[model samples]
Target: MKITVRQEKAIDFEDITLLNDIAFGQEHEGLLVERLRKKTPFVKALSRVAVFENSIVGHILFYPVKIVNELTEYESLALAPMSVIPELQNMEIGSQLVKDGLETAKNLGFKSVIVLGHKDFYPRFGFSPAVNWKIKAPFEVPDEVFMAIELLPGGLMAVSGTVLYPIEFNM
Candidate 1:
Protein backbone atom coordinates (compact mmCIF):
# COMPACT_ATOMS: atom_id res chain seq x y z
CA MET A 1 0.00 0.00 0.00
CA LYS A 2 1.25 3.43 -0.91
CA ILE A 3 1.08 6.23 1.66
CA THR A 4 1.35 10.00 1.41
CA VAL A 5 1.64 12.49 4.25
CA ARG A 6 0.52 16.06 3.75
CA GLN A 7 -0.98 19.09 5.43
CA GLU A 8 -4.65 18.66 6.11
CA LYS A 9 -7.11 20.66 4.06
CA ALA A 10 -10.42 22.23 5.04
CA ILE A 11 -12.31 19.38 3.41
CA ASP A 12 -10.60 16.74 5.54
CA PHE A 13 -12.10 17.85 8.85
CA GLU A 14 -14.85 15.30 9.14
CA ASP A 15 -12.66 12.44 8.05
CA ILE A 16 -10.04 13.46 10.57
CA THR A 17 -12.65 13.55 13.31
CA LEU A 18 -13.72 10.04 12.42
CA LEU A 19 -10.17 8.77 12.36
CA ASN A 20 -9.49 10.23 15.80
CA ASP A 21 -12.69 8.83 17.23
CA ILE A 22 -12.04 5.33 15.98
CA ALA A 23 -8.40 5.37 16.90
CA PHE A 24 -9.11 6.37 20.50
CA GLY A 25 -12.47 4.59 20.83
CA GLN A 26 -13.91 7.69 22.50
CA GLU A 27 -15.06 11.22 21.90
CA HIS A 28 -12.69 13.06 24.21
CA GLU A 29 -9.76 13.24 21.82
CA GLY A 30 -11.97 13.82 18.85
CA LEU A 31 -13.69 16.68 20.63
CA LEU A 32 -10.37 18.14 21.64
CA VAL A 33 -9.33 18.18 17.98
CA GLU A 34 -12.49 19.96 17.02
CA ARG A 35 -12.24 22.53 19.77
CA LEU A 36 -8.56 23.09 19.17
CA ARG A 37 -9.26 23.89 15.53
CA LYS A 38 -11.29 26.87 16.64
CA LYS A 39 -8.73 28.18 19.09
CA THR A 40 -6.44 31.16 18.48
CA PRO A 41 -3.19 29.18 18.74
CA PHE A 42 -4.20 26.59 16.16
CA VAL A 43 -1.65 26.38 13.39
CA LYS A 44 -3.45 25.32 10.23
CA ALA A 45 -0.24 24.58 8.34
CA LEU A 46 1.10 22.27 11.03
CA SER A 47 -1.90 19.96 11.17
CA ARG A 48 -1.29 16.89 8.98
CA VAL A 49 -2.98 13.75 7.78
CA ALA A 50 -1.76 10.46 6.37
CA VAL A 51 -3.53 9.34 3.24
CA PHE A 52 -3.55 5.87 1.72
CA GLU A 53 -5.59 4.86 -1.34
CA ASN A 54 -7.35 8.24 -1.23
CA SER A 55 -8.39 7.80 2.40
CA ILE A 56 -7.13 9.60 5.47
CA VAL A 57 -5.68 7.00 7.82
CA GLY A 58 -3.94 9.10 10.43
CA HIS A 59 -3.79 12.62 11.88
CA ILE A 60 -1.47 14.91 13.89
CA LEU A 61 -1.65 18.47 15.22
CA PHE A 62 0.86 20.89 16.66
CA TYR A 63 -0.36 23.94 18.53
CA PRO A 64 1.55 27.10 19.24
CA VAL A 65 2.75 27.00 22.85
CA LYS A 66 4.58 29.21 25.28
CA ILE A 67 7.19 28.12 27.78
CA VAL A 68 6.89 30.67 30.56
CA ASN A 69 9.04 31.20 33.59
CA GLU A 70 9.07 34.03 36.11
CA LEU A 71 11.15 36.04 33.71
CA THR A 72 9.52 35.53 30.30
CA GLU A 73 7.64 33.34 27.84
CA TYR A 74 9.32 31.51 24.98
CA GLU A 75 7.50 30.51 21.81
CA SER A 76 7.21 26.84 20.91
CA LEU A 77 4.91 24.17 19.54
CA ALA A 78 3.08 21.30 21.20
CA LEU A 79 2.20 17.94 19.67
CA ALA A 80 -1.04 16.51 20.87
CA PRO A 81 -3.60 13.75 20.31
CA MET A 82 -1.96 12.12 17.29
CA SER A 83 -3.97 9.19 16.01
CA VAL A 84 -3.96 6.40 13.40
CA ILE A 85 -6.56 3.89 12.30
CA PRO A 86 -6.27 0.97 14.69
CA GLU A 87 -5.81 -1.63 11.98
CA LEU A 88 -2.76 0.25 10.70
CA GLN A 89 -1.22 1.01 14.08
CA ASN A 90 2.20 -0.57 13.49
CA MET A 91 2.59 0.42 9.84
CA GLU A 92 4.30 3.79 10.52
CA ILE A 93 1.45 5.98 9.30
CA GLY A 94 1.53 7.93 12.56
CA SER A 95 5.29 8.18 12.40
CA GLN A 96 5.19 9.61 8.91
CA LEU A 97 2.58 12.13 9.95
CA VAL A 98 4.72 13.17 12.93
CA LYS A 99 7.90 13.41 10.84
CA ASP A 100 6.15 15.44 8.19
CA GLY A 101 4.47 17.69 10.75
CA LEU A 102 7.71 18.43 12.62
CA GLU A 103 9.56 19.19 9.39
CA THR A 104 6.78 21.53 8.36
CA ALA A 105 6.86 23.23 11.77
CA LYS A 106 10.62 23.71 11.55
CA ASN A 107 10.34 25.13 8.07
CA LEU A 108 7.74 27.53 9.39
CA GLY A 109 10.32 28.77 11.94
CA PHE A 110 9.15 27.11 15.13
CA LYS A 111 11.98 26.80 17.65
CA SER A 112 10.88 23.79 19.67
CA VAL A 113 8.13 21.19 20.01
CA ILE A 114 6.72 19.67 23.19
CA VAL A 115 4.70 16.52 23.63
CA LEU A 116 2.99 14.68 26.48
CA GLY A 117 3.33 11.27 24.94
CA HIS A 118 4.69 7.80 25.29
CA LYS A 119 8.24 7.91 26.61
CA ASP A 120 9.51 5.20 24.29
CA PHE A 121 7.62 6.29 21.20
CA TYR A 122 8.59 9.99 21.16
CA PRO A 123 12.23 9.41 22.10
CA ARG A 124 12.72 7.78 18.69
CA PHE A 125 11.92 11.16 17.14
CA GLY A 126 14.72 12.86 19.11
CA PHE A 127 12.51 14.06 21.98
CA SER A 128 14.09 14.10 25.44
CA PRO A 129 12.60 14.62 28.85
CA ALA A 130 11.67 18.27 29.20
CA VAL A 131 12.72 18.09 32.83
CA ASN A 132 16.32 17.90 31.70
CA TRP A 133 15.91 21.39 30.29
CA LYS A 134 14.22 22.62 33.50
CA ILE A 135 10.78 22.67 31.90
CA LYS A 136 7.59 21.55 33.60
CA ALA A 137 4.08 20.71 32.52
CA PRO A 138 1.11 22.82 33.64
CA PHE A 139 -0.43 19.80 35.26
CA GLU A 140 1.17 17.02 37.16
CA VAL A 141 2.24 14.24 34.83
CA PRO A 142 5.15 11.89 34.88
CA ASP A 143 8.37 13.67 34.02
CA GLU A 144 9.33 10.95 31.57
CA VAL A 145 6.15 11.45 29.53
CA PHE A 146 6.64 15.17 29.05
CA MET A 147 9.12 15.56 26.23
CA ALA A 148 10.55 18.27 24.00
CA ILE A 149 12.72 18.59 20.89
CA GLU A 150 14.53 21.64 19.69
CA LEU A 151 14.03 22.36 16.01
CA LEU A 152 16.82 24.92 15.95
CA PRO A 153 20.22 24.47 17.51
CA GLY A 154 20.26 25.69 21.12
CA GLY A 155 16.51 26.21 21.00
CA LEU A 156 15.87 24.74 24.42
CA MET A 157 19.21 25.53 25.98
CA ALA A 158 18.29 29.13 26.72
CA VAL A 159 14.60 28.60 27.44
CA SER A 160 13.21 26.49 30.23
CA GLY A 161 9.86 26.85 32.00
CA THR A 162 6.25 25.67 32.18
CA VAL A 163 4.41 24.78 29.01
CA LEU A 164 1.13 26.65 28.65
CA TYR A 165 -1.17 24.48 26.61
CA PRO A 166 -4.10 26.14 24.97
CA ILE A 167 -7.33 26.42 26.97
CA GLU A 168 -8.91 23.88 24.69
CA PHE A 169 -6.47 21.27 25.90
CA ASN A 170 -7.45 21.99 29.46
CA MET A 171 -11.16 21.98 28.73
Candidate 2:
Protein backbone atom coordinates (compact mmCIF):
# COMPACT_ATOMS: atom_id res chain seq x y z
CA MET A 1 0.00 0.00 0.00
CA LYS A 2 1.20 3.49 -0.79
CA ILE A 3 1.22 5.92 2.14
CA THR A 4 1.44 9.67 1.70
CA VAL A 5 2.98 11.73 4.43
CA ARG A 6 2.09 15.42 4.72
CA GLN A 7 1.78 18.25 7.17
CA GLU A 8 -1.53 18.21 8.96
CA LYS A 9 -4.33 20.49 7.84
CA ALA A 10 -7.04 22.04 9.96
CA ILE A 11 -9.63 19.68 8.52
CA ASP A 12 -7.58 16.69 9.70
CA PHE A 13 -7.83 17.50 13.42
CA GLU A 14 -10.65 15.16 14.37
CA ASP A 15 -9.26 12.38 12.22
CA ILE A 16 -5.84 12.81 13.80
CA THR A 17 -7.36 12.77 17.27
CA LEU A 18 -9.36 9.66 16.56
CA LEU A 19 -6.35 7.94 15.04
CA ASN A 20 -4.26 8.71 18.12
CA ASP A 21 -7.02 7.58 20.46
CA ILE A 22 -7.41 4.26 18.66
CA ALA A 23 -3.70 3.66 18.24
CA PHE A 24 -2.96 4.31 21.89
CA GLY A 25 -6.20 2.94 23.36
CA GLN A 26 -6.81 6.19 25.21
CA GLU A 27 -7.66 9.87 24.82
CA HIS A 28 -4.66 11.26 26.64
CA GLU A 29 -2.42 11.43 23.62
CA GLY A 30 -5.15 12.93 21.55
CA LEU A 31 -5.70 15.58 24.17
CA LEU A 32 -2.01 16.26 24.36
CA VAL A 33 -1.93 16.94 20.65
CA GLU A 34 -4.82 19.35 20.95
CA ARG A 35 -3.24 21.18 23.84
CA LEU A 36 0.12 21.46 22.18
CA ARG A 37 -1.41 23.01 19.09
CA LYS A 38 -2.45 25.99 21.15
CA LYS A 39 0.91 26.54 22.77
CA THR A 40 3.69 28.86 21.61
CA PRO A 41 6.15 26.04 21.00
CA PHE A 42 3.88 24.20 18.58
CA VAL A 43 5.36 23.93 15.12
CA LYS A 44 2.51 23.38 12.69
CA ALA A 45 4.76 22.06 9.96
CA LEU A 46 6.11 19.36 12.23
CA SER A 47 2.71 17.86 13.00
CA ARG A 48 2.23 15.39 10.20
CA VAL A 49 -0.10 12.65 9.08
CA ALA A 50 0.21 9.53 6.97
CA VAL A 51 -2.57 9.06 4.48
CA PHE A 52 -3.51 5.70 2.99
CA GLU A 53 -6.28 5.50 0.44
CA ASN A 54 -7.34 9.06 1.34
CA SER A 55 -7.69 8.39 5.06
CA ILE A 56 -5.37 9.46 7.83
CA VAL A 57 -3.85 6.30 9.29
CA GLY A 58 -0.90 7.64 11.19
CA HIS A 59 0.23 10.81 12.95
CA ILE A 60 3.42 12.25 14.43
CA LEU A 61 4.19 15.47 16.27
CA PHE A 62 7.44 17.27 17.01
CA TYR A 63 7.18 20.12 19.47
CA PRO A 64 9.84 22.54 20.64
CA VAL A 65 11.40 21.80 23.98
CA LYS A 66 14.41 23.04 25.92
CA ILE A 67 17.60 21.51 27.25
CA VAL A 68 18.98 23.81 29.90
CA ASN A 69 21.42 24.32 32.71
CA GLU A 70 22.44 27.40 34.70
CA LEU A 71 24.47 28.74 31.84
CA THR A 72 22.27 28.34 28.77
CA GLU A 73 19.17 26.88 27.13
CA TYR A 74 19.34 24.86 23.96
CA GLU A 75 16.31 24.37 21.79
CA SER A 76 15.40 20.97 20.45
CA LEU A 77 12.41 19.10 19.08
CA ALA A 78 10.59 16.45 21.04
CA LEU A 79 8.98 13.60 19.14
CA ALA A 80 6.08 12.30 21.05
CA PRO A 81 2.86 10.27 20.73
CA MET A 82 3.48 8.99 17.23
CA SER A 83 0.80 6.52 16.25
CA VAL A 84 -0.67 4.34 13.50
CA ILE A 85 -4.02 2.66 13.54
CA PRO A 86 -3.90 -0.91 14.87
CA GLU A 87 -4.89 -2.48 11.56
CA LEU A 88 -1.96 -0.74 9.91
CA GLN A 89 0.70 -1.35 12.48
CA ASN A 90 4.06 -2.56 11.07
CA MET A 91 3.10 -1.44 7.60
CA GLU A 92 5.68 1.38 7.81
CA ILE A 93 3.09 4.12 8.08
CA GLY A 94 4.54 5.20 11.38
CA SER A 95 8.01 4.91 9.92
CA GLN A 96 7.06 7.13 7.02
CA LEU A 97 5.66 9.75 9.38
CA VAL A 98 8.87 9.73 11.41
CA LYS A 99 11.16 9.96 8.41
CA ASP A 100 9.18 12.77 6.84
CA GLY A 101 8.76 14.62 10.11
CA LEU A 102 12.44 14.51 10.91
CA GLU A 103 13.40 15.79 7.50
CA THR A 104 10.91 18.63 7.77
CA ALA A 105 12.28 19.53 11.19
CA LYS A 106 15.82 19.65 9.90
CA ASN A 107 14.86 21.77 6.94
CA LEU A 108 13.13 24.13 9.33
CA GLY A 109 16.47 24.50 11.15
CA PHE A 110 15.94 22.29 14.16
CA LYS A 111 19.30 20.91 15.25
CA SER A 112 18.23 17.73 17.03
CA VAL A 113 15.29 15.71 18.25
CA ILE A 114 14.49 13.74 21.38
CA VAL A 115 12.12 10.81 21.61
CA LEU A 116 11.00 8.47 24.34
CA GLY A 117 10.40 5.40 22.23
CA HIS A 118 11.30 1.83 21.45
CA LYS A 119 15.05 1.41 21.45
CA ASP A 120 15.03 -1.08 18.59
CA PHE A 121 12.69 0.84 16.32
CA TYR A 122 14.24 4.33 16.56
CA PRO A 123 17.87 3.28 16.02
CA ARG A 124 17.31 2.62 12.35
CA PHE A 125 16.60 6.36 11.99
CA GLY A 126 19.94 7.13 13.77
CA PHE A 127 18.49 7.69 17.22
CA SER A 128 20.61 6.68 20.20
CA PRO A 129 20.33 7.02 23.94
CA ALA A 130 20.10 10.69 24.93
CA VAL A 131 22.32 9.90 27.86
CA ASN A 132 25.24 9.71 25.46
CA TRP A 133 25.02 13.50 25.18
CA LYS A 134 24.43 13.99 28.90
CA ILE A 135 20.76 14.82 28.31
CA LYS A 136 18.22 13.76 30.89
CA ALA A 137 14.47 13.54 30.84
CA PRO A 138 12.50 15.62 33.33
CA PHE A 139 11.20 12.39 34.76
CA GLU A 140 12.80 9.04 35.34
CA VAL A 141 12.99 6.74 32.38
CA PRO A 142 15.17 3.88 31.29
CA ASP A 143 18.23 5.02 29.39
CA GLU A 144 17.57 3.11 26.20
CA VAL A 145 13.95 4.22 25.79
CA PHE A 146 14.89 7.88 25.81
CA MET A 147 16.72 8.59 22.58
CA ALA A 148 18.07 11.49 20.51
CA ILE A 149 19.13 12.04 16.92
CA GLU A 150 21.29 14.87 15.67
CA LEU A 151 19.86 16.32 12.48
CA LEU A 152 23.15 18.09 11.87
CA PRO A 153 26.67 17.10 12.79
CA GLY A 154 27.54 18.21 16.33
CA GLY A 155 23.91 19.14 16.88
CA LEU A 156 24.00 18.06 20.47
CA MET A 157 27.72 18.56 21.05
CA ALA A 158 27.28 21.81 22.98
CA VAL A 159 24.02 20.68 24.61
CA SER A 160 23.80 18.71 27.84
CA GLY A 161 21.09 19.17 30.40
CA THR A 162 17.60 18.08 31.48
CA VAL A 163 14.83 18.50 28.94
CA LEU A 164 11.99 20.79 29.89
CA TYR A 165 8.80 19.79 28.15
CA PRO A 166 5.85 22.13 27.84
CA ILE A 167 3.24 22.17 30.54
CA GLU A 168 0.81 20.45 28.23
CA PHE A 169 3.07 17.40 28.20
CA ASN A 170 2.72 17.03 31.95
CA MET A 171 -1.04 16.81 31.80
- Kindly list the per-residue Cα lDDT of model 1 for residues 1-171, writing each as its tens digit: 789988889899999898889999988788898999988878888889989999999999999989999999999999988999999999888888888888999999998999999999999989999998999999999999999999979988778889988788767
Per-candidate RMSD, Å: 0.9, 0.7
Give the top-scoring candidate (TM-score).
2
Task: Judge candidate 2 against the unseen true structure and give its global Cα lDDT, from 0 to 1.
Answer: 0.93
Q: Write one digit per residue (lDDT tens) for candidate 2, span 1-171.
A: 988999999999999989889999999999999999988968899999999899999999999999998899999999998999999999888888899998999999999999999999999999999999999999999999999999999999979999999988789
What RMSD does model 1 have? Answer: 0.9
Question: In model 1, which runs have C-alpha deviations exceeding 4 angstroms?
Answer: none
How does each model score on TM-score? 0.97, 0.98
Model 1 scores a TM of 0.97
Task: Mark the regions of model 2 whose C-alpha exceeds 4 Å error after superposition.
Answer: none
Give the TM-score comparing model 2 with the true structure, all chains together.
0.98
